[model samples]
Target: MRVVKAPDVRRSEILAAANQLFQTQGYSRTSVDQIVNKVRIAKGTFYHYFKSKEQILDALADQLVLDMAYHSEQIANHTQLNAIEKIVTIISEQNRLQSEQQNVVDSMHLPDNRQLHERINIKIVLTFGPILATVIEQGNQQGLFDVKDPLSTIQFILAGSLFLFGEGVFNWPPEQAQARIQSMIILIERTFGAQPGSMIIALNQCLNEEKR
Candidate 1:
């Protein structure tokens, strides 16, 4: 008798294989054949789950956003950490995730990856905004932040930063990127009514940790 996997489990296996290939081989170079071979699945089976390689990529992006939101929620709900600390923790988690997936992250900057990159950014904001907004809302209740609309504030923040780092959008030089990042820190601080330099310090620390 042959053991059978559930549809969701099989889909996840396909995605896992695709993710590993995309990481090691780069998205453009990783074909559906490679993914199906990795999973020991037939071509028809692969198509049963995903219409095309691009569909798999989109699913991967959705998975990334969901994972990020899950991690953010964990940090946001840590009872011992204050509102500011929770925000910092969430940022640190983001940096850590990016670092771990650096290769995949770098691929998103390729010229051909523009459309997928935009879709990922939109998914990230849609998924992560509410998680961050919960932290911001808690901060407001604690008098640690003053944002009038937590969800909208978080959404704007994500969109602005995404636009800055977007591959084809700004094409910012190192100096320009640094300047924009600093400005973003200031904007976030003011938006949250946090101390003038607090977010800068926290963000710098997170960046330093990412480098390690």
Candidate 2:
């Protein structure tokens, strides 16, 4: 394996540690002092790369986008699943992420949560929206989806999926959470309504959407 430079390697390690800590603990509760203490570095060294706590958080958001993009690639490459199946897989992954995040006491409960949530939404859109679009276009071309606007359909799916995540986090009665996700997915699948013998056209439209 090629060796990474010491500083870049160290920076990534530090950021990874910080991301976990800050995500699990409230941003307000996490401190650079705590980060340095866990990273086993001196406070002076922590300050050398990051001037303020806010800067580190900004970096964390950037990293989140990169991770989401990685996930999108994984969704696109599932061989046994076609476009419609991939959409279900996408939502499944989102559900898994929501479950993981629920354990974290983050700023999502605070007044400033709106700002953070919007930022996260924008990142999610940028990273995964294209993948959703490709699937929608494929479904439409194959007559599997009756949607006239593939773009708008993808947008709705993204928004709806996030809403499911919100309900899981905020709604009471675990069964309600399950019902919400199932209802949304049912809505999406009905909207798409995949049919047999359309795989060829589906693949073509998916490729065309990627070119757009």
Candidate 3:
């Protein structure tokens, strides 16, 4: 018997199956047939939800950004933390999640996945920019920041960070990458007129905890 499911439920299953295949076998190696087989769905059913494998990848990217945005928003709205603390906590949580899903990250960096990879970066900028900007705005109002335009400033910062750290785009040596990370911390502090080392100390403390 053909099992029927809601459109959204079926689509989620397709994406979930595709994500697993992509993680284990990589994007180029995983095809439409493999995804359909995993979900036990017909080719027509797959096509009904997604026009092409590329389109599916785009949807997956959007989902990834949405998940990240949800977590960041939760941190942004926390009454206990100030803006700086919110920023640090959000970043720390994101890094921890990414580290746990290293396979997904590695899959996105695979051959023929550049477009998918780039799409995710752009989506992150669009989705996360607004959320982080709200935090910055809160900081600005509290006299903890001096940003002239919260949205634009955060979008610029996010775009730069994504591209710079995006693995396939730039293969920086560990030392160079660390240097850039430190420089970025300083740049953010200066841009927001934060007291020197304030952001650095907080961010490093979070990062150190991750290492332990």
Candidate 4:
């Protein structure tokens, strides 16, 4: 008897196969046939779910962004956490996800993948901006943050961080990079009207926990 998988399950299988191939063989060299073969699926089956190889790449990026957004939204909705705690939780989860996907991140940074890299960055901002904005707005209402526009502020922070910290955008020496990161953190605190060291301290604790 032939087995028929559910649509979502089958699509996930295809994506998992493509992700592995992309990681091991590089996206530029991975073909649709390779992905289908890896998943033991027909070319028609792959095309049924995704229009093109580029779309598969986009789907992969969507999955990553959605995963991060889900985590952020969950934290944002938690009634027990204040705005600062929510922000710290969201960042910590985002960092953990990014670190887990570091290889994929590095692959996207390759010069040939610049277009896809840019698309992924935009997707992140679009998906996460609103989720983050709500948290910031909550902060504003609670007097934890003073922002005229929460969504705009979040988008700006996301875009600037992506640009400044994106791989190959700038190559700074170790000390310079550290200084710039410090400056960015301080700027973020000021932007939110947060206490001078509160965000810095919270972020440092988050990072230290990640390291452990």
Per-candidate Cα lDDT values, in order, are 0.81, 0.62, 0.84, 0.84
- Candidate 4 lDDT over 1-212, as tens digits, reads 65699999999999999888877777788999999889988889999999988788777777888898988888999999989999899989988887766656666787877998999999988998999899999998888899889999989998997888778888667667666777877888999998788789887666444433
Residues 1-212, model 1: lDDT tens digits: 54478999999999989889988878889988899889997898989989998788778776766777889999988999888898888888888787666657767767777888887888888888998899999998988888999999899988987887666777778778677777777888898898777678887676445434
- Where does candidate 2 clash, by residue pair? none
What shift in Å separates residue 26 of candidate 2 from its native position after superposition?
A: 5.6
Query: Candidate 2 residues 1-212, lDDT tens each?
Result: 53344888778877877777866776788888889888888787778788877667667666555655677678867667666667656655654554454423244434555666666766676667777787677666656676667666777777665554542246436565555545554565556664433333433343223222
lDDT of 4 at 56: 81
Which stretches of candidate 2 lie above 4 Å from their native place?
1-7, 23-28, 97-105, 141-143, 160-183, 193-212
- In model 1, the number of clashes is 0
For this target, which candidate reaches the highest TM-score against the unseen true structure? 1
In candidate 4, the residue pairs with backbone N, CA or C atoms under 3 Å apart (3 or more residues apart, or in different chains) clash, namely none
Off by over 4 Å in 4: 21-34, 51-54, 204-212
**1-212 in candidate 3: lDDT tens per residue?**
99999999999999999888877777778899999999999999999999998787777766766777889999999999999999999988887766655556666676677878887888888888999999999999988999999999999998998888777778778778777777888899999988888899887666444433
Better of 1 and 2 by TM-score: 1
Between prediction 1 and prediction 3, the one with superior TM-score is 1
Q: How many backbone clashes does candidate 2 have?
A: 0
**Arrange candidates by TM-score, highest first: which order?**
1, 3, 4, 2
